[model samples]
Target: MSAPDPVRCAVIGTKTIAGQHLPVLQTLPEAEVAALCDIDAEALGETSRRFGIERTFTSVEDLQTWGEFDAVYVLVSVLAVAEVSERFIRAGIPTFLEKPPGLYSSDTERLAEAARETGTTAMVGFNRRFYTCLQAGREALLDTGDVVSVTVHADEDAGDKWFGEKFPPEVSMRWAYANSIHALDLLRYLGGEVAKVTSVVRKRRLPKPDSFSALLEYESGAVGRAIADHFGPKGSSHWYEARTASAVLTSQARSSPGDRLSSCTLERHGREPVRFGLTGLDRRLKPGFPGESRAFLRAVQTGEPVSFPAPTLDDAVRTMKMIDEITGAEEWAPKPAS
Candidate 1:
């Protein structure tokens, strides 16, 4: 059978993450980035020139007026995600939103409700959930048996300070939801929704808590634990592990520095371990971008649910709620005298 025609995608932001996603979307056989949009003309021009995207617009109103693309990728700032995405969703156009989906879970809730009310297909980009390594590890774990436990380690050196120069005070104050959700969401993607907080410890180094550790019980009867500290010497890192009765699956977040491919290993007793390394496409594009873009475009083309593991807006809402609960368990204490 012949392959389906590509979905025409119009990207709504032209900086940083959009820059990373554009090339990957172009590389997908199922997608064609037909238009680019950004309020900043210079950034839009630079991205349009860099990617050779000819159709460009300076505003969502202008893009909607043109209305030529089949799907839209809302890569706007964290604060603007809901407002921008709601327009596309309510218009009945397939919408793909970049992560954090909003500054808070409430924003995600608003988008989810809009999607349901309009019966539009909307997905949120939780790129880590699409990492090839994590996908392989998850499949292997599920094959072994029901997942009994999961452990995730997420840390960033000076994360609170890292965003100070780049984002507004509001975004900086809600740092965990804006950024750490990338790793924390993995807990739900791999294990399940956190049913209860078994225990929690939090430390505030700055205005917001900078370190957290928690034990959780999942709705699936599985147990999970996570430790997130922003005091590491390295910039950022994530480690994931999930266990079943027969095997253990572990992975280094695909975006980790110095790793060209997503590094994953599945170990089973009385059998040789299996390594789930990068595919050719992963090596060529951002580690997970090809899979992520393909998943979204596939859903747009077939009018199907997003491919397995790629989060729809509703799934992202769930992840955001979990993050809210986890980060809400913060505790403040006076610093020890040095």
Candidate 2:
């Protein structure tokens, strides 16, 4: 059968991460940026002009009324994702939501429930799954044997600049849930659902905790460990290492944000170590922005959910469940008014 026409898409949020998404959509023949939305009128106007998008709005209400788009991408702040996504899902517009899907399990659960009832498709952005080395490593690790253990090491140097001053301290303390989730989600992506997670955190110079280490047990009998620190000097980031019965697969994140590079190394019992530069991964491997966008487009076009290299809301919710288990318990969720 022939494919469907390109989806006219609306993107909410015009910030740093959304910037990464723009070029990708421009490259995809199956999708177009039909509209743009942001609360900040200046950013909204600038992004629309820069992208040559004729439609722009400052709120979801305005976008829904006049914006003609079949799909939407929610790139708003983590705190805002739940409320924003609920609106889109209820409107029956298929959406692509960014990572740290929601800070609260309740919020994410509500989103899943709304999507199901509304018959709206929602995908969570977990871009790490598209990294070629990680993808190839996951494939080989599973093929070799049961994945016994996985270890993720990630660090950043965000310093004391988190949340600025407007947000409460509780939001600041959820640093682990906000960032290290990428590592945890990647573990679940390869090892199946997580059964349990225990975390030990240390607070240092930062407003919230400065570092955290966690141990996770997956339902597939695979165990995983995650260690993250924002207090690191610099040139610190994420890496995933998976060990199967016969071999071990490891992926290293870029040493610095200025460089777009990640390396994957595979070591078998007696074979030579294999290394791959994920920077070489194009849209085909689904590495970075384009790869993920391509994955989203596939499901949007085929009307089927993708799991291998791409993921749906179900996968994202499960990851969020695990994240809430470790970091965003009731204490982290928002409280009622007085």
Could you tell me how far off, in angstroms, the CA of residue 54 lies in candidate 1 after the best superposition?
A: 1.6
Best by lDDT: 1
For 103-209, candidate 2 gives per-residue lDDT tens digits of 76666778888888987878888887777656666776677889899887766665654646744465556655566667667777767778889987667767555
Q: How far out, in Å, is residue 144 in model 1?
A: 1.7
lDDT of 1 at 190: 84
List the candidates' TM-scores in order: 0.91, 0.88
The regions of model 1 sitting more than 4 angstroms off are 160-163, 199-201, 253-261, 329-338
Candidate 1 local distance difference test against the native:
0.80
User: Clashes in model 2: which pairs?
Assistant: 286-291
Candidate 2 structure lDDT: 0.74
C-alpha RMSD of each candidate structure in angstroms: 4.6, 3.0
